[model samples]
Target: MKQRNGSIQQSKLKQAEKLLQRYEMDTWLILTREGSDPSMPLLIGVRSVHQAAIFIRQDGQHLALTSVSDKGNYEGTGLFSKVVVYEDSMEEVFQELFQELSPAKLALNFSASDHLCDGLTQGLFLWLEDVIGAESLSSLEISSEKMLKELRSLKTEQEIERIQQAVDLTTDIYDAVFSQMACGMTEIEIGQLFVEEMKKRDVCNGLGNPYDPPLVCAVRNGLAHRKPSHYQTRPGDIVIIDFSLKYQDYVSDIARTCYMLKPGEEAPPEDIQRAFDTAIEAITQSIYELVPGKKGFEVDQVGRKVIEAAGYPTIRHSVGHQVGRATHDGGTILGPQRIPPRPEVEGVIQPGEVYAVEPTVIQDDGLPCILVEENVLVTNDAPIILSKRQTELVTIKKNQVI
Candidate 1:
């Protein structure tokens, strides 16, 4: 399916406004240059402004301060509400805003823990501090996390549509790979093929685009995170393809492993098959126990226990993480480490939140590892799988010969 840009739902904006109010912040400012870096995702949804300093004040005022040279570029974008062209200094613009709004507390993007809040560089922050002056700067606080997290975690109808399209396209690519997969194909060849198909489908949209395609193919029996190499696939080898695509800035991650077979070969090594089955069980258990009120660590333990009970090594990574603009979008993760018993995460698994439940397991011998991942959307009762999950091990043969 051809992917298109999705609009940000007004409901999400309202939700954000409510969240800001809850945080007790009177005004929020999203100040950035060119609206590219950390603000790109948010600005992309904006319908007005261009080449300007974008500001979304607390009183619901949207201001765009830009240079005359680039005013035309943003004027037609329909992203900003008001445009202010600055030929020299932005001091006047700042002064006017300060006097008009006179906000008690101004929220700036600067979080020590979250990368999303750190989008405002040190230099730009200094400039903003100077612009606000000593008194206003003191009133200005760094607590944009609430706004950033709420904006990203809550998806709009349009954003959901775009993400669904990306998920469908990824499923199609997987089907195509399954049809032409062979035992002798090298890992690089497989990865390149996936990339070619993504481009043909025009799936490049948000971060890690054409340069770092979401689809990653790796052929390592035991190494889960190894980069794709030129190593040729052999019979009985376990091949894994871990990939995702960013649709309208949101991300979807999926992974599947296939077993190659020699001519006349009916099955994989008994041990490998056992490991694969165990991994699948872990995933199933994890999904079954996942719910709105449960802690992330609790869900992770369900999966971890399954693998350990099967006499397999525990997965080094978390069971899964929240998926959004960035692959590892901000919010609580479904892992043992992040989801501790005490001081639990604040939010629940809302219906709109998207996640990846990837359960991994390593066999005792450490030769072959099994991993299965799928994107899911939380519902009132059960989570719905966005990408098709691999139920059985895929078998690829050297040729069609007898």
Candidate 2:
């Protein structure tokens, strides 16, 4: 465990060094209390209590000011060169330290667009003002969005391995589901089967709502971001299953849409087929355009254009999103249009980042909706599809064997 923590710190430090050099930052400051910051587990490998601040200089110097109780976990990794601890109040000690290493620019973990970076709460920010003093706080910069996005979205080699394991598990679970699915099953019934199978297979459960997995949205009943219900699934109904499992702390979030065919049917209806093809093409085009240096909107445009060109109503949501620790892992967005305060949706996609391309076109011919979401890893040349890409609309026929 100690070695694993050390390795993660080393990897983050290496990346931080490069980011500092590229941006000419003076120091990166991360403030958190009670594990409010998402970077806490990744940086220190433990939940934190009491207020704490981690300072990383552009020259690779790491310093931490934390409560005595939390000092050991942060110090155990040997990642912090200097560890300052206090029993009661941190104001006196913290002010002195701030005076000594007065950074010209300080990166705070707050963003208007990304929630992962926006971990610092308003109440805590006010308390920190007293801890560091008004003068020192004035020197800070709200430029941590770019830094956090680059660090969080970009995966290391080991992280990719863990993610791949989760992805494969999800694919296997898909097989389990398709094998057992039949016509006349309720959405909740299928969901129950999924829960049982995941337990039997011992797959890790996802966060939020606790009892339920991610979601299993059936045709005409639910769309993107909606949960499943007791709605009965019928023959020729478009069924979309969206679920994920956790391997260690990594997550695999993949979704697939298929047609529930009647007896002796091999393929879905014509309209459904065309919609699936358009979504797949959009995904392919988006992947091909996802090389480094391209803006987020540019990659999203590839999918958006393909769908709109094919005469389908444009999807209101973005083309895709970054997937990692969380399903919508924040910052690195792959979307053409976004509402205000998320203006940074046009940021460039960097190599080593992972994303989920989900583009959906509704099938209005009394058929189900068509949405295909696949995972991808951004590379220098072409983005690599991470999960097993769906090539066709799966025909779930009666009495079909796996």
Candidate 3:
């Protein structure tokens, strides 16, 4: 485990170094005031320093600047190589460092298009401008969004392992729910059951709130991304579950639909079954074209075409997105419009990238919507589905249901 953790850190460091080299940047400055509140939320790892400012140079050097009160906390992390403790003037400290390094170009976290790149607040930006002066501030440039995208897009072996573990645990929860789903249970009840199971297994919701879990189960309103309400499951009702388990800071998103059976009914309505099958086909077809080199929009088109051909209206949302530390992480997304339009995204898909393929189909009546979501990892050959795909609709008998 220790070796694996070390390997992941090394991989991240190597990627950071390569990004610096690619951009021809002299230094990458990540200034943060608090530890848990990192420069960017996605970069906040276990080794992150709190109540300190961190600086990473192009030469793979780390320097942490913090006050005496928070110096001990940053030092305890043992992540930074050089820990510089300051007593009351960050401006003076930064000036001295600026004079010494005097990098031709300093890359700061600021981008108009990318949310991750825009981590630096407006107030912080003004402060930085004041300290660095107008000339030096103008010389400072924004870090390429591609650098941030690539750094987060490529998952290390440990990250993959943790995500896989989360997938497996979620699968178990699905199985357990499948075995007990029955008519008369409210959507909230079943959603709570999933949370209970995840808690039992020591998994947490990525939202970081212990009291509230990240479980969204909607009956008949699957098309709407709303929370589960007090509506109880009735015969012929479709209950859709959209959930994920956060394990070791990694997340797994999975969605499945369950059908409530009437007292004498043995199978779901043919139309319901057809909708479910069409959703599955859309999801499977989307995965087929999820290779590295293809444009993200192209992959989305594959699924949209499948659904449209099946006589269903196009899904309102994107086919899928890249998943990592946060539920929605990274720049390259498998959606209708690929952001940036860079050739690198068109570059062949490499191993170690994980994504979630979610395809939804709504009935003409605007009633229940069938949604199938599964996490997948892009390999050299083809994408591997991490979460178990819903092969058939889960049926819950009236009396036998939870």
Candidate 4:
């Protein structure tokens, strides 16, 4: 794709070339059949019923081998530089072509540690060996994962703008939720309101396949991620409205907390205030430490120490996770604080990455859970918090006009 003017295709190809050089990959291969490889949607933006292989070379060349039927699909996008079509025998043609563009090493979409990277099916793996022969197979490595994580984590300017729009929409949806929320409203009712508002703006889930429902959990003492239920939200209840929106093929994971107050109440109870403050502090510390060259766990430690020092139970989840096309995006996560056995990715943090910083605290009065999650993008300097920070708790006034 030789288009200028900051097109999405330009961004994708630009990143692909950088990734090739960054990882020193000779050729990156993506093979799929019947859409078995979920990564195709992110990599190529389309799937094929017939078998196909897209090759990205270190020399900034993109080549595709596909059935005649799928040729137009890729060619239409202008993503690949060359297209080789096969009518009867794909194996015969691919093997001959593979010899001509001989690469020292080939990266396949397979990784044992990460499921998102493991898109190559067993049938395809076997088929590849049969088609390419043992010599070509000897040069194959499942290093696409390393490049994939890099590709997904490094957001282009266009992609960052799309993500910001999604976050803005999600923020607006939460604002509507707090505005209309009232005492004695069932969780299902409020959850429905969220869905209705998002639908009005045509916001979809961040994940593409199999639609996801909005999360509106009303819990008194503990925090949980669950579907909205029939449980009616009562006065003084702390509600966690976890919501995300898909805008321009990007998604946002934003969680906002609201407290239902009795009529004429001016401020929240001291216990609730303390919980919100502590959670905010955790988020603040994590954001401060979110810089390149630091380990992910080091950032996690800052958040966990602040929460635990305040005499609250540490969250049972990671301090933060990468957020992008998917809610739980790929690569280096801000590993859990105060949790045993760290993940390998906790070791490093990179610039041009985005993460969702979420921390939960059980209210001091033993009545509610206060959790605040925000999206942030790591820069060469300080991390940029994408969503508007929830500085004050949302108040629900019963029968009060907005």
Candidate 5:
């Protein structure tokens, strides 16, 4: 479905106003030069080549201060209440806007934890200080981390629909590729099949890297994010395929495990079955705890505990992460608190936020790790599973050939 950008921008601006009130900030000042801040496109749906400042206020007023070249871009949107264009110097106009707004607690797009919120450059920050002077710089004490996190994380209805479309497309591609799988095919060859299918659909890789192969790993390979290798798939090998595809600007990330059976074997070995089941159980229990208002680490603990109880090694990575514009979209992370705990782990989960929950079960023996990742949407009630959940391990028959 094609998204209506106009409606989305209007909704976003309204949400920004509410977030401003929640954070007790007067204005959200986003400074950009040559499209520096990534949030600018998200906030204003426009990119500026020259220096620009977007002021979104708590009173639902929006203003844009930009070079004359980019003034039409902001005005065309009609989302901003005022568009102030400057030709020679932005200092005078910027100063005038600041004085008129008199934001006692100005929030800037800088964060200590979330990278998405840290778009202001060090040079621009120093320049802003010089423009506003010391006393006024003190008023720029607030960080737009938490507020921006919510603004981006809480997906609107249109966004959710767009993401759902991406998930469906990825799931279909997985099915087509798995159905065509055969024993003795090299990992690279199998990955090529996925590339071919994605080309037919005209969708790009979710990671946006042409070299980023859908991590196809045979039994001997470890659970590391690497390109597909020349290792050939053989009988009795457990193959894991971690794949993602981008639809529109949203992304879908899902992983599936496949077992290549030996001649005349009806099922996979007992150990393989046990490991896969353990991973599935971990994902199931963790998803149940993924309710709104819960901390990211709390959801992570549920999966970690389940994996440990099943006699597996402690997982090295987080159970899940926020999924949206980017595969590893920056926001609340479902992970453990380490020696120096991540501030993002303490971030609260909100309704409308989608997470890619991947609880992995690693084997010390020569068995492959079982990671059945699912894209889930957090709602007021039960979490909605966006991708088709992989329950049983996909088995490739000995007779099957590519």
Candidate 6:
């Protein structure tokens, strides 16, 4: 575990240096206290209880200015080349370090667009302004969004492996719970079965409340994100489960569609199968566009075109979003350009990013909308499917359920 942690730290440090050089950033400053910044663990390998300021210069210099109480946390990792501890005031040390670097463009963690890059709080910002004077602080480019988008969104080999494990476990749980599903089961009951299985594995929900992980929706519920209700699933109803599970701090997002078969019916109606097929094709075509250097919105258009050309209403949500530490891991979004927070969708895709591509088919018929989500990893050659793809509808019979 220690060796793996070191590898992650080394890999991230190399990536950060490359980004700093590419962006012409002279220095990258990270300030956190009492675990204030969520990105600290990813950037520094450990969260500090006391105040700390980590500086990374484009020339490959690494330094940490931390309180004496929390000196070992940063020093123990061997990540920083130098560790300076201050017992009283950090202003003198911080100012001295800034002057020593004499950075032309200092990058700070603050952004109007992305929360991942906006970890520096308002109070901390004010403290820096006081320490360095407002004129000097304001002159430097403070927003690290451009650099952080690449740093955080791009997953390392270890990160991808953890996400894949989470995906595998989630699909296994689905397989077990689906076999147990039967007629006369309420939507909530079916959801509970998933929760029970999750307990057996000792994992938590990837996104929302743990007790209510999967969003169980029947044909009558449409494609809403509401909690599972007392509504009982009947024969010939399409059941969609939007499920996710967190394993070792990584999360997987996958949605599966199941058709409850009537006694005589061996398969779903023609229209339902057609809708499912279209959704599957949309996922297949969109994943092909998930290569590095492609724009997020450009990849989104491929899936949108597939779904729209199939005579269904345009998908209401983005075809895909990044999935990592958080469900909406806040990097490039595979969505339309006009969507609010346009910068997210407009960002360029990079290798090592994992995305959950979900395309929804709106139905005018009595059936509900069909949705199938798959988690994919972006690579230089081709995108890899981390989750087992839901190609065909999962059929459940009243009596055959075990």
Provide the overall lDDT of each model, using Cα atoms, as 2-decimal numbers: 0.68, 0.78, 0.72, 0.79, 0.87, 0.86
- On the 0 to 100 scale, the lDDT of residue 148 in model 6 is 82
lDDT (10s digit) by residue, model 4, range 82-194:
98999876898888778888877888888766677788998888888888776668656646877787777888887788889999998988877677778788888887887
Q: Candidate 2: deviation at residue 234, Å?
A: 1.3
* Segments of candidate 3 deviating more than 4 angstroms: 1-7, 35-51, 211-222, 338-350, 363-368
Q: Give the candidate number with the greatest lDDT.
A: 5
Q: Give the TM-score of candidate 4.
A: 0.91
CA lDDT for candidate 1: 0.68
In order, how many clashes per candidate? 11, 0, 5, 1, 0, 0
**Candidate 6's residue-wise lDDT over 1-402, tens digit each?**
766776777778888899998888879998888888767867777778777898987777788999987888778888888999888988898889889888788788887878888999888889988988899888985678887887779999898988999999999999999889987789989989999999999997987776565999887655588888999988988998998899877799999988888878988889889999999999999999999889989999999999999898899899999998788888899999883558988898988899999978877546557889999999989899999888888888985542
Q: Which residue ranges in model 1 land beyond 4 Å of their true spot?
A: 1-6, 9-12, 34-36, 43-52, 205-226, 338-347, 363-366, 400-402
Clashing pairs in 2: none
lDDT at residue 214 of model 4 (Cα atoms): 70
| Model 3 lDDT per residue over 1-402, tens place | 544544565567667778888888877776665433333334423333333456666787766777777776556545567778777778888778767777777777766655755566676667788988877788676665667777777888778888999888988988877776667878777777777877788777655464354445544544456666778877878877777778876788888887888767888888888888989999999899888677777888899898899888887877887777777765667767546654433434456788889878866444657877999998889789988788888888865643
Candidate 5 lDDT by residue in tens digits, 147-235: 88887899999889879999999899998988889988899988998899889888878875843569898867555678889888788
Of 1 and 6, the candidate ahead on TM-score is 6
Candidate 5 vs candidate 6: the lDDT winner is 5
Q: In model 6, what is the error at residue 336, expressed in angstroms?
A: 0.8
Clashing pairs for model 3 are 35-50, 35-51, 182-401, 292-349, 293-349
TM-score of 6: 0.91
Better of 1 and 3 by TM-score: 3
Residue 317 lDDT, candidate 3, scale 0-100:
79
Candidate 6 — which residues are off by over 4 angstroms? 209-212, 339-341, 363-366
